[model samples]
Structure formats: C-alpha cells, structure tokens
Target: MTASDPSGPFRLLAQCPPGLEPTLTRELAALGIPAPHQTPMAGGVMWNGGWEQLLRANLHLRVASRVLVEVGSFRARALGELVRKGRVAVDWERIRAAAGGDGRRIVFRVSASRSRLYHEGAIEARLREAGELPDVAGVGEEAEPRTRDPGEAEEFPGVAGPGDRADAPGTPILVVVRVHRDQVTVRLDTSGAHLHQRGYRQHVGTAPMRETLAAGLLLQGPLEPDGGWSRPSLVDPFCGSGTIPIEAVLLARRIPAGMASVGFVPRDFACLHWPDLPPDVWEMEVARARAGIRPLDPERFAVFGSDRDARVIEAARANAKRAGVPEEVHLATAPLSKAPHPDDSGWIVTNPPFGTRLGARKSLRPLYAALGRSVQPGGRMVGWRLLYLSADPVLDHATGLPLEVRMTTRHGGLTVRAVAAR
Candidate 1:
C-alpha cells in the first residue's frame, strides 16, 4: 500500500479548544490555507495542508491544542467491515518508508460514542493488518525495556521507556478512529506532541500556565488579533516566571512558537515523504522573525512585571532573557497592588494565584481588594482592563470597582474570569 504519489501531500488535521477555533482559523487563513472545518469533538478542529503548512501551524498558532493529519476516513457498520476497511485504507509501504525501513509500529484509538459497534481488540487488529506490523501484546511487555539496566537507556534509541514518551523520536503512525452513530473517521496524528511544549520553560513556579494558553489569554485582552502587542503596554502583575510577558514578546516579534524548539512530533511524521522540505524555508522564517522583531526598548512601551517574591522576579528576568525579550520588559519586586505604573492607558493581565492552587482563601482577599484599587481612577485609568483568572466572585466586591465580567473559561482545572472596568 504505497502512497498514491510522493508529490501528493497528506491530509492534515489540527485540533484546538472549541473556544479557540475562530482564532486558529484566522491564523491559518493568514497563511493562505483554507479555513478549518469545525467538528463536534471537544477542543477539536480540522484543517488540510502539506509539510510546510503543518510546520507553520506548529510554529505560528497561538491557541491550537494539537495538530493531526488525516490518513484515511471510511464508513464501517460492523467489526468485520471495520477490519476490512481499515486494512485497505492504510498505505503500508508509505508507513514503512516513513519509518526509515524499520519494522513499523501502529497505535489504534477507537471512539464509539453513539454506535453499537464497540470492539477495541477488533479495531486494534484491523489497524495492525492495515499497517502490516506485529503487535507487541500487553503493556507490561513494553515496560520491560526500561528495567534492562540503567546503562541500557540509550540502547533502545528512539523507543521511549515508561515515563519518558515525550522524548521518544522516530515517527510511529498512529491511527485514530472515531465512530459517531454509523460513521468512522480515521486520522494519522502528524504532530506527535502538543505544539505548546516549546521546551523553553525550564524553570516554572506554582500553577505555571502553558505558553499557548498564556498567549491566548494575552490576545483576549488588549493585544491586536494580527499578532501585535505594541499598544496598551502589557503588564503581568503576578508574572510567574514571565510566561505571559515572554509570549508577548514572541507575538510582538512575529516569532513562531516553536522557532527555538529542536523537535516536534510532526518532524517524525511520515508526511515528509515528499521531496525534502524547501531548503530555505527555515532560514527564511528566521530572517522574517529577525526582521519583524520589535526593538526591546523598555521606555518605548511599558511591558512591566512584578511579583511579591523577589526570587520569582529573578526567575522572570532570567526567563525573559532566555526568550530574547529581556530588554523589552521591565521587572520589579512588589505586590500586585504596588506593581510599577506603566503609561496611563495600559492593560493589566495576570494569572493570580487562585485560592485552590495558592492555598488559604482568607489570606488573598486583601490582595485582590488592593489590586482593584491600584487599577482605579488615579492609578491606571477607566480604559484599563484587569483580566484575571479567579474562582471567587467576591473579588469584584473586594476590588470595590464596578467591573463587568466579560468572559470566563476553564484553565488548569480552574474557572477563570475576565473583568473589564471602563
């Protein structure tokens, strides 16, 4: 089952939170790719593209959860039909070639939400037949590779042992089959890992938000949709290791999320089966990033951050330097109420430590109240918006400001509310 033609690119599918579908679609549209077709799955969206577009999605998308490529889609009414259709749809030769001629491994994921055809083993067997690969039975058998010896860790090469699957290299073709009612849709996951794990946040503090999530939160605030962070001087009063500020700089410079990342799940995917990706693509991206990078002049626009703990402020400074936006940010050691004042009309966006994650609800009330006062009349302005994630509605009363709750969403298993005061 060789690929139809190496020239014909595979059908790529990218997934993200339902709330972010519109933002992701707009991002793809800017690259000249067609808008993604929406699906009912939670945090799922579908898009089509080749290797270059796939790379661009991984690098540029600020809100997508993960990107997957569609390998095949078929309708199967019964177990036998599933087996037959699944095996016939896979291109074994292409899978083997993508694996660099090694014995290929196939993973089958089945979802039978509203259908009677729910047989996991049969589906796995069908996928195995499709790829012409041997299934190493049982999870325990896979775990045996780790106990061979500490020195044998490197012997397995690309195979991941027990807890380290994130580091595993060499693409294994994954078959994801979702059966809704009587229809089965099978897709091959091209982006192996979620694109958010850019591998830069070596040091993280309590409840550190993901880079992608932080970027989305920022965009939802004062930042423009077209990747511009120039206006409304951004400030993260609770700057935990500076994830938000660092992401702001990346957005300002038009630097793709995964630009500094060395590995992506898509890199190992079989889709690169085409003539090697254009040699200058990467170089051109880098040059574009350099050209678009806004000079990090602290005085130009107020990108300020502050934290009560001096140690956390140190961490934020270090992380900002690593992100190549050290000069663009102003760091200070102070509580949220005392955070440095930027231009009169800037935005205050921070992920304050929630009572659940930070502990002791009673202790944080005073802090929230003070935060409200700091952003009021003489401090910032009527146009200044305080976008924060809080579980306590009492925070509005604590702030003593007549703020309108604009939007709310769940992040890190906590309810986040965005409030705007005009």
Candidate 2:
C-alpha cells in the first residue's frame, strides 16, 4: 500500500486516434482500470487511477500512444492567479521525494482552443514558479527552459534556483496546461516518450512502422486476444524490418516494452523519487517479464516475413534474430503477390509499399490488385488503411471480393486504414 493509493485516486490521461478510442477504452477495461471518460478534444482521452493502475496501464496497454497523470484543473482568468493556484494544488514535497535525488525538472505544455485568456508564456512561467525551478546553468541563451531535449546536457543549464543542488534528490515534474474558455487544466506527465518505442527494435529499415501502430492494426484483425498466440502462426507479407511479427510475439509473451530500451523518460523522471517506489519493485517487474517469456513454437506460430527487396528481407531476418524471435520467424524473399500462404485461416497483415518515399508509384496498383487476389476468400488481408498513404484503393475494387474496413489509424504521419475479409 503506497501513499498515493491510500490518499485518493489519481487522474490519468491517455491519447489515441479518435476512431480507435473505443478499442483503447476496451483495452483499459480489460486491465481493470476505471472506465475512461472521452474528452471532446482531438487525440486525447481521460481516465482516473492510483499509482498501481498507472503502472499497469503503462505495462499492459497496447493502444495508448502516451499516458499522463492529472495534477490539477481550475479556472484562472489571469496568468498570476493561474501560477499561484497551480503551485498550491500540487504536493511539491511528495514529488521531490519521488524523483530519487534530482529536483523535479518541471516541463510545461499549453494548449488553448477558442479562449480569450490565451497566453502560453504566462502559463509556463507560473508552472516554473510552482515547481521550484531547478538551477540549470551553462545552457545557450536561445534555450527555452521547458522544451530542452533530455539528450542534451548542456541545454538543461544545471538547475533553475538555489534549492536545486547535485545532492538534492527530488521529483522531476512535467506540467501540461490546457486552457479552454478560461478553464485551465494542468496535468503532470507520468509516461515519458510515446509508449510505442517498446525498446526492442535495434535494427530499422528504410522506413519502419512503430510497435504501437502495428499492435493497433493487429487488434483490428481476426487474432483472438486471450493468449491466442500459444500456437500462433503469424505472417507479415510486407514485414519491413519485422516490426509487426516482433510486436505480436512480445504481446503474446507479455514482455514489457521497456525491457529492451536503454533509456526512457520515466527512468529520469521525478516520480521515481517517491520513497514508495522501492528498488525491489523494479526488480520484481523484471523478474515477472523474464518468467513470462516462453519459447515460441516454431511450427505453430510460424512467424514469417517477406519483401520484394532481398536486402530488406535480409534486414528483417537479422532484426528478428536480434529480437530473440529468429527461430520463430521464417524470413524469405518474395513479393506481396507471390508470398506463400501459411494456412487458409492464418492472419495475413502487411504494410505494402505506399510509394511515398520509394519510386514505386507505377507498381503500386498492380501490386495491390495482385495482393487482393492472393488472399483467397475466407482468408484475412489487412493493409495500410489511409487512402492517401497508399495508391491502391483499386485493389479492394479489383479483388472483386467483399471487403470490410475494420479500423482507421495513423502511422508515421500517414493515416492507415485496415481492411479484413472473412
């Protein structure tokens, strides 16, 4: 029982595509997190929970792009009052303790939609005063205190105030201020860096899809959720560096996304400064991840990747091996139209060349047409859903096969639309 859990429920905010909100909501429900309330804002969703629920959401959520903790929300007509109220609302002492030994690096983000009291700089100033600005020195003059990239040490400028010292351990806080019609809502970021990194992809091809996007696309498929991959036979006909199949294996095995990554924003955050987060808890997390990993059945799941470019296929094979799923994934050099069929009912998901970067515009239509024909009736075919992302809408029309649009999502700045036919 941590102090946060006993004090009261914590408010959490998660961001995802508008169309996929229902799916994300369902995902939260499965994890036992309180049902989230949908906000009218674009690309934002709200939920409430304590520290335990926050950790669970970070570990188990497959659809959320990022998870944030709500610190406070209030109405402030002017900048002065806003800062004063924000500082008083948050428990700075508790936050400082959670950050390990570093004073909380308070980050502020302001968003205003149709509001008269629209001043981003003012909101930021208030947040800094409230967070007890750490002393950051030697940074360049152009450096804005809040937007400093974590990778650049010189950019951080040491600490902001006299209280910030090397030996002083405190929580690093990120404050996001959203002002709509005089209403100011402030939130502290709990999950740093978009949740999609998942850490494992050491090798990237010319263009690689994010793990989160791949998972969302898979969720739109016919794959069962309840440990269905025990004997899973997954195939990505256009597997670029094997992201889809790799993510599938991770989810099937219940591996934590951060296990493979060296650094995450959460690791350097102030929340870990809290005394409640004992070192044993982190060790236990690692232990659970290790125990959950089971040897994948090469014959059953039979993960496979195919690409027209032999070099890309080679890269995918090497990447799968690096991710520890080499034996499970069978990489081969084949075009989408010529890829071998695993089983009549097997899942066939791919992100075919969209001809956006590669000079393959002339070949897209025919390639999509051939792909549609390849998936015989009663089999599944999922592809990038966005109309602009790919030049093959005719593929759906050409297959002369009945198709259903399952979900629409965004991947790497391109909107993706997933389709399936049973």
Candidate 3:
C-alpha cells in the first residue's frame, strides 16, 4: 500500500457537464470519497486521492464525462521558462513514479485561452521538449513524419504523435496543457474516451441520449424521487436506442456503469502501465465491482420504452440485451399519438427532438401534446410527473402543460432545459 501523502500534490479532477457538478459530487461521496470540492460551471470536482481513487472513479462515475489528474501548474512568461518549468522544475520522474515508472507512449495536446502565448504550435513544441519520455516499441499506428516550418524542432522525440479517434487502444498518456495569460495548468486525461460511450449501445438513433446525460437525468432530477418513483417506472415514449431506460435500470440495480464497457481505457490509462502499480489492481477492482452489484429483483424495477419507428424499438431491444438487462426492459413500437402508458405509473424522462427548422418544429406540436396527454390523459391524473428535455421553449409550449423549468444544460451544442409537469 502506498503511504498517505498529507502534503502531496496528487489530485483527481472529475469532469461532468456544467451545472451537474453538485450531483457528481454527491455521487463520489456515496462511493466513499468524502466532500469533493465543487467546481461549478466548470463541470469538474477536485479532490485529493491516489491511484486507487482514480481507478475507482473511472469504474463508478456515471455523470462524469472524464477524469483528469493534475500534473503540475506553473507561471511561464516565455517559451524558455515554460520548458524549464515543465522538465526539471515540475519533477517529471516523481509524476512518472506515481505510475510506478512504467514507460508509456505520451500523446500531448495543448489549448490556449486569453494567453500571451497565442501561438499554439510554439506551446506544443515547448511541452514536447520538456516532458519527453522514451517511445513505446512497436505500439501505435505509424505515420509519415509531420513537416515543420522554419524554426520548428526536429521530429517530436519519444512521442508517437496523435492517436486515431476511431481506434483509441494503446493510447496511454494524453497531456493537456491549458494556457491562460501567464498561467499554465497541465493535466493527464485518465478517461480515454467520453464516459457516455458506455460500450453497450453499438446502435444509436437520432438525437440519442448520452449515457452521462441520461445518468444525470436519472440521478439529479427532482421529478423522479419527488414524484414518488422509488423504484421508478422509467418510461421513454420516444425511446431512441433505449439510452434513458437502460441507464435507469442499471443505476437501480447498483451495477457499475462501466461494468460491461469492454474496451474501457482504464487498462490503457497511462498510470496503470507504470511498473510500480499492481498488475491486477484494475482487474481486482472490476471483480470487486462485479461482486458489489445488488442484482435487481425481477418484480421490483419497472423499465419500459416505446417509439414511433418499429426499427427503434428493435434497436432498443438489442441494446438492452447487450447491456445485460433485456429481462428488465420492455419495449414497444407506436407513434406518439398511440404511445402506450406503463401499467404501473412511473416518471417519464426523455430528450425530445429539437427541430432545427421552423416548419419542422410546427409539425411537432401534436407530438408534444400527445406526450402531455399520455402522462395525464384528459381528466385522469396520477401522482406521476413528466420530465423531458427540450431545446426550444416554443416547442415545449405546445405540450399545453404548465411546465416548471427544472434545469438548463447543453445538448449537442444547443441550449436545452429539463422541464417537469403533471
């Protein structure tokens, strides 16, 4: 066991969507990391922990999009200062030692905002020179050397270059340098892919709900528990690809969201490759998480989904089966006007289509009205409530229900809000 470091700089940054910081904070707490300091609007919660804590996060965090470990921060007024601060000053060996000195192939990236170092290429150049590592043998895709202009340094020594977005395996270290004014904050991305790519949904439908956003909607939205859905009859009338309902059932079952993420990057994570860490640490954690799951009571959790397209229903079924919850999910195909209601009353959560064209949007009113009526048809009302995500207020207005805005967050670069109604 690594001894505790009271004055050590080992810190993990859990990144979530903006405005969902508090929800992620409580989630980390529930998993035994106490009092995560909230970085609101930034979508990150900073907490002190070592390698094990970092591994636990990638295994457990449902709302976090990625987990970043801070490497070092320094003030650099010039390129030379940046290089010096990076290599000798920042203690690269100690940072590598944290990973137990396992040689890794580093892929470095940098971004600058409001900084005097406006030249991103120069900044990238400096980081490469400073924190250089020996290149991995026979790993990573080989590509022709990228040409450099006038004063550019020779080929990036020990760096194998940028990774292919499609095949991300063997990608260990991703150095992120964020420069603002004279300050530079360096971090290593521990989560290789976006957390929402939960590995189960090989198939997807239009405007599909992101697994991270789906998890946030299930965990943080007050309309759920407050609406008396203890076990939650999670219904997504327009359930495209079954992201919401499947995520709900997984959360209810106490299943680690990453349990079946077949190609999860935790094994390829830079620190895990380091020599000092145990080879079975990640496997043991995965096993422990598997042991920790409190499997669902067949009759306890109710999850159902329906869609206008028969194809989407078919897709949802396949996705839910791959997620190992086919028995828990019930799917059907029908237009919104003929949407089926859950026999057992449950809260409704969905990300409705955000029509980009006005004419296309106008045609969606009846769909929204059908949604409103489906929850509380005509005069028959239940204790159940509806929480749906919509991009346009004008679109939501057609639902004809008095929607109280619950939260506003971005979806697919469009500003969207989660509104609740009965």
Per-model TM-score on C-alpha atoms: 0.79, 0.76, 0.81
lDDT (10s digit) by residue, model 3, range 15-81: 7777667777777776666562333436578777666677778777888877777778888878988
Q: Write the per-residue lDDT of candidate 2 for residues 1-422, one digit (tens) a residue.
A: 53123243667777665556666766666555434343423555566556665665665566676666766777777767776786787656544553445344554556675676676665666656766766343122223444432221111223221112322433234445778887877766555445665545656778787666677766765343323542346677788788877767756655544443222112222233347755665555456546655656656566667777787777777766655566666778887656655652466676777765445655566766666656554424433221112324554565555667777666555555676654
* Highest-lDDT candidate: 3
Q: Give candidate 1 regions above 4 Å deviation.
A: 1-9, 34-42, 92-94, 104-109, 119-122, 137-175, 260-292, 296-300, 357-359, 378-383, 394-397, 402-408
Regions of candidate 3 where Cα sits further than 4 Å from its true position: 1-9, 36-41, 91-105, 133-172, 222-231, 261-271, 279-284, 377-382
Task: Output the worst ten-in-a-row residue range by lDDT, candidate 2.
Answer: 153-162
Write candidate 1's Cα lDDT for 1-422 as tens digits. 11112233656556654455556666666555644333334555554445566666655677765566666667777877876776776555544544444444555555566776766556656666655667644422242332232111111223332123432454344455667786777765544455565555667777787776677677775665456553658788899788887787677656666553222111222333323445465455446544554454555456778888888778887777766566677888987657786655677888877776335676777878777877766754345677765667765567777777655555665556666655
In angstroms, the error of model 2 at 236 is 1.0
- Return the clash pairs for model 1, or none: 192-265
Better of 2 and 3 by TM-score: 3
Ranking by TM-score: 3, 1, 2
